[model samples]
Target chain A: MLRSPDLVGKSQDSLREAFGKSLILLAEDYPSLVVLDADVAGGTGVHHFRKNFPDRFIQCGIAEQNMISVAAGMAETGLIPIVTTFAVFLLRAYEQVRLSVAYSQMNVKLVGSHCGLDVGPDGGSAQCLEDIAAFRAIPNMSVIVPASPIEINQATRFIIEHKGPIYMRSGRSPLEECLDNSYKFEFGKGKYLSRGSDLTIISCGVCTGRSIQVVKDLKELDINVELINMSTIKPIDQKIIIESAKRTSKVVTVEDHSIIGGLGSAVAEVLSEYHPTPLKRIGVKDTFGESGEPDELACKYGIDQVSIKNTIINWLKNETKG
Target chain B: MTKSVKSNVNYIRSLIVSSIYHAGSGHPGGCLSCVDIVDYLYRYHMSYSFLDCDNVSRDRFIMSKGHCVPTIYAVFCDMEYISLSELKTLRKINSRLQGHSHRVAFPQVEVSTGSLAQGFSFAIGESLGLKLQGYSNNVYAMIGDGELQEGQIWEGAMFAAHHNLGNLCTIVDYNKMQSDDLNENIIKLEPLQNKWESFGWNVFNIDGHNPNQIREVFSAAMSKENQKPSVVIAHTIKGKGVSYMESIPSWHGSVKLTEEDCRKALKDLECTDNEIEVLMSA
Candidate 1:
C-alpha cells in the first residue's frame, strides 16, 4: 500500500500539520517532550501542541537563536525539546546549532517547517532551500526530510526516540500520501516505492511523492523507472542508493531543495565514490526562488513532473544514440 | 561568613593563578573579576555539589563566559568536586578542563558554553523545565558584562521576565573589557541597570569583588517572595587582584603566563608559602 488508507480520500495535507499532530501524540508517551517555537506556531503548525500542552510548550517570542539555545538547555535537564521555525530562519541560529547542540551533542530535535519551493508566495526568504546543506555539514547533526504527511508522522516519532541533534524539515504546501500506516520510518534508510530497470529516480521530501506519480506515468509509457525515497539526507542510505543505481544503470536525483549539497549531491557523492554511474540531479539550479504559485515555481525551478519527464526523455534519446 | 568567603576566594584565586599560569594560556582577567560572585554561589547558594551530583534537589549553575573556565575548575578543585591534581590540567590535551568549558569534558558544567549569551538563554529553559517538573530549585548563570552585548542575552532577559521565572537568576560580571578592547569602544552598555529593568527583570546593582555585597545581592535575588527573573549587576575592574594584569586588556585571555607572572600573581592574591605549595601541587 503506497498510500495510507486513512489518507486515501483526502487529496492534500501539509507536512507541518502532520508534524504538529505527531508531536502532540508523542508527548503522551514521552512526558519529557517539549515544543519550542519562535512565534511561528501558525506557520510551523505547532499551535495545537502549544494549546494541548501549554505547560510543555515554550513560546520563545521572535528570537530564533535564543529558542535554539534554550532548547539545548532544556535537553540538558532530561527533557527532549523540538525547536520549530521556518527552514530558512533556522539558519539564523546555525552557529548556535553548531555550538550548543551539535558540538555539545545535546538531545534536541530541530524541526524546520516551510522547506524549499513549496513555501510558494512567501518567496526565497521564507523558503528554506539551504537547510539540508547547512545542517548536514555539521558533524553530529542528522538531517531528515519526510516524503509525505504519513512519513512526517513516522519520522517525527522516530526523532523523538533518537537521541542527539537532528534537523527534520516539514513543508507548507500540501503533500500527497506516499507511505501507508504500516510504513516504519528508519533513520539512514531509503524506501523502494516502485521498481524498474530503465533508470532510477532517487527523490527526497515532496519530490519523492511526485516521483511516485512520475514513475507510475513512465511505466505506462514503457520507460520502467525505479523510484527510491531517499528521505534521510545525512547518514544517507548508501546501500539502497548503490544497489538501485547499479540495477538501473542511470540515476536521476530529485529534491525540493537546491542541486548543491542536497539529496542530489548526497546520491552523487555515494555513486561517484563507490559506483561510477551516469546521474542527473534534478532540483533548483543555483538560484533564489521568487513569489509564485508552488506549481509554477516547481515547473520554473525544474522540479515539476513535466521538467523531470523532459530530462528523462532527453537522456533516453542520448542512450539510443549511444 | 564574610571573612571565610574572603579567605576561600583568595584560595580559589591562587588555584586559578597557578592553573592558568601552568597551562601557559587562559583568561584570568575576567576570572579574577567574576570569581567572588561564582565562588559565593557555590558555597552559600547552589544546592548540589559536583562531588554529590546524585542529589536532584539542587540548583544548577551555568558559566556563560566559558573562556574563564579555569576559574570554574579552581572553584571545583577548592570545593573538592575534582582533585587538586586535575585542577592543574586546565588546557592540557585530553584533560577534562578545556580552554573553554565543555560539559562532555566536565559534566559538572550544566551546559557547554564559550559562545556568549547562549548559556544565559539555556538557563531560562532549564528554569522553565524545572518549573514543569514542579521543582522549585533555581537555575543561576553568570555572564561577563561584555557578553551582555550579544542579542541572545537580551532575548533571554525578555523571555525570563515575561514568563515570570522567579527561579532564574543572572549574575552580570560587569568587568567592562571584552575580547579585543573595552566594551565602551566596542558597545556602550550605559544605563545597563535601567535596560534590565526595562526588560522586566528584578535588577540589583553590586560591587562584583566585594564578598559581602555578592552575598547580600544573591539573598535578594534568591528570595522566593519575588515573582520574576532577577539580574545582579556586579560592577568591578577587569582584572581585580593582580597588579600588572588589573584592567590590562592584553591579560584578558590566551596570554602566556611566565614563571615570574605566576609568582607575581600569587603574591598579588596574598598567598602564603604553604598556600602557594598546595595550589601549585601536581
Candidate 2:
C-alpha cells in the first residue's frame, strides 16, 4: 500500500498496524508466503513481517504494476504473495490484477491500506474513496473490508486460507476493537455486533465502530437499533442483511467511502433485489475529501457517531414502508 | 547443418500467416518478427516440452507482448502442444486461441497477456519465485520495441535488476514498429541497449531473424554466473519471413490477411505444394 508520509495519531492504533502485525503470525503457518511492497511497507503495516522474514519480503521499489504481476507470477510457482499498497495506488495496476491474477485465477491476495477517507491529512489524492468500486467491478475478485483490528487479524488468516484472487482493505485511522477473542471470520457472512428491532444499521470498515457507538447511544434514548458489521463486500452477507431488514423494516448503511458503489450501494442492490425496505446510505455524497483531521473528516462526511445518530433519529421517525 | 531446425522454422512461419489469414483478422507482422526467437527457445534452448508439459520445473516462456500470440500458437503447433487443426481455429468464436494470450481459455498459456509490459513483470515474479523455491527453471519473456514505451516496462526492468533475477532472460523483438507507426515516430527508444545495461542488466545485441544467433544468445543468457538479469535486443524486420509484409508499418497487424495474401506469404517462406495444401486445408 502507498502510504502518505507523516502521521497525526499513533500508527499502532490503525488497522494497517494490526494488518502488519498479523503478517508476522501468518509467516509461521505459511513458509511460502511472501509479501511484495512498492516502498510502502511501513505505511501498509508489513514492516513487522519484513523484519521477521527478510527472505520472504520483496521490496519492489515504487513500481506497483510490476509488483502486482510479479505476485501473480510468484503465485504460479506455488508461493502465495500478498501484494500490499495504498488503495488508490493499487488502481494503477488494476489491469495487471484483472488479467494476470484474477483472470488467470492465480492464488494471490491483495491488501490495500488506507482504503477510504480514514487516510487523514494526506488530502484527496492519497485518500482512496473509489477503490471498492474499482476492485468490485473486476470478476473473480473477492472483496473484504475488515471493521476493526481484531477482525483484520482474523480476516488476514481467512484470506490466506481461501485460495484465488482476493482484495482486502483496512482504514488508516485507529479503530476500537468491536469483536472479542471468540470472534471467528466467516466467508460471505455479516457479524451482528448487537441485536434490536427498531432499525438496522449496516456498516463496514471504520464506519462499523462509529455505528456501534451510535447504536449504544440510541439504546440510551430508547430507540434500539441493530448493528451489522459487513466485512465482505463482494459475496456480501445477504442473508444477515435481509433478515435484519425483515425484523426492523428500516436499513441504513454507512462507510468511509463514496456512497455510490460501496457498502451502501451493495446493500441497496441486495435489499432492492431480495428484501425491499426503507434504506438510507450515509457516506461521502459523491465528493472528494480534503486535508482534515481524522475525526473532523468523519464528522464532515456524515459518518461519525453524532451525524449517524442524528440522521438515524430523523429517518426512524419519518421513513416508513408503504 | 541444422536441417530439421530450418524446415521447422519455415513451417512455423507458414502456420502463423495461414492462421491469421483463416481467422480473417490477426496480428501478422509483429508475430512474424518474433517467430524465430520463440521457436528457437521452444526447440533448442528451453526445457518446455509438449509431452511433459505438466512439469513445473521446466523452463517457462511468457509472451509479454501478448498481441503477438500468433507466434506462440505457431510455435506450439510445431511442438505438437496443439494440433494443426486447432491452430486454424485461431481468433474464431468458441476457439481456445484468442486474439491475445488468454490462459483461462488456453491452459497452456502461463499468463494471459494482451496489454503491454505486464508479461515482462510476470516473468520477473516467476523468476523470483523459482529462485526462492531453489528451482533452476528460467523464465523467458519476449517484448516488442514499441512496448518499451509503457512505464511498467521500466518499472519491471528496475525490479528485475534490483532483485538480481538471474533466472530471467527477456528478449526485445526490436522490429521498431508499433500498431500505428514506427517506434521512432511514435515514441523513440533509441540508445535502448544502454538503458538496459544502466538498469544493471546483462545486455546482448543480435539479429532476431538468424536462427543460430537466437539459439546461441538464449543458451548464453541461461548462465547464472553474473547473478543479473539478461536482456537480448534482437533487431528484426517487422515481418521477417513474409516478404509481402516485411519492414512495413501497415502490415503490423493493422491490415487483414486475405486468402491471396496468405498464399503469397506462405510461398515467400518456400512452403512446397503439399505443405501449402496441408496448411491451407488445416
Question: All candidates' lDDT scores?
Answer: 0.85, 0.86
Give the top-scoring candidate (TM-score): 2
Candidate 2 displacement at residue A15 in angstroms: 0.9
Residues A1-322 of candidate 2: C-alpha lDDT, one tens digit per residue: 2122231122246888888877777788988899999898889988877887889999999888888989998988889999999998899889989988998888999999977778889998888998888888889999999888778888888889898999999777777677776877787899888999998999998888888889889999998888898999989888999999999988999998999899999999999999989899999899998899889988888878999899988877777433
TM-score for the A-chain in each candidate structure: 0.95, 0.94
Q: Is the docking of candidate 1 incorrect, acceptable, medium or high quality?
A: medium
Q: A7, model 2: CA deviation in Å?
A: 21
lDDT of 2 by residue, B218-272 (tens): 8788876859999999999888888878888988874687778888898899887
iRMS for model 2?
0.8
DockQ of all candidates, in order? 0.69, 0.78
Candidate 2: the clashing residue pairs are A1-A84, A1-A85, A1-A86, A2-A85, A2-A86, A20-A45
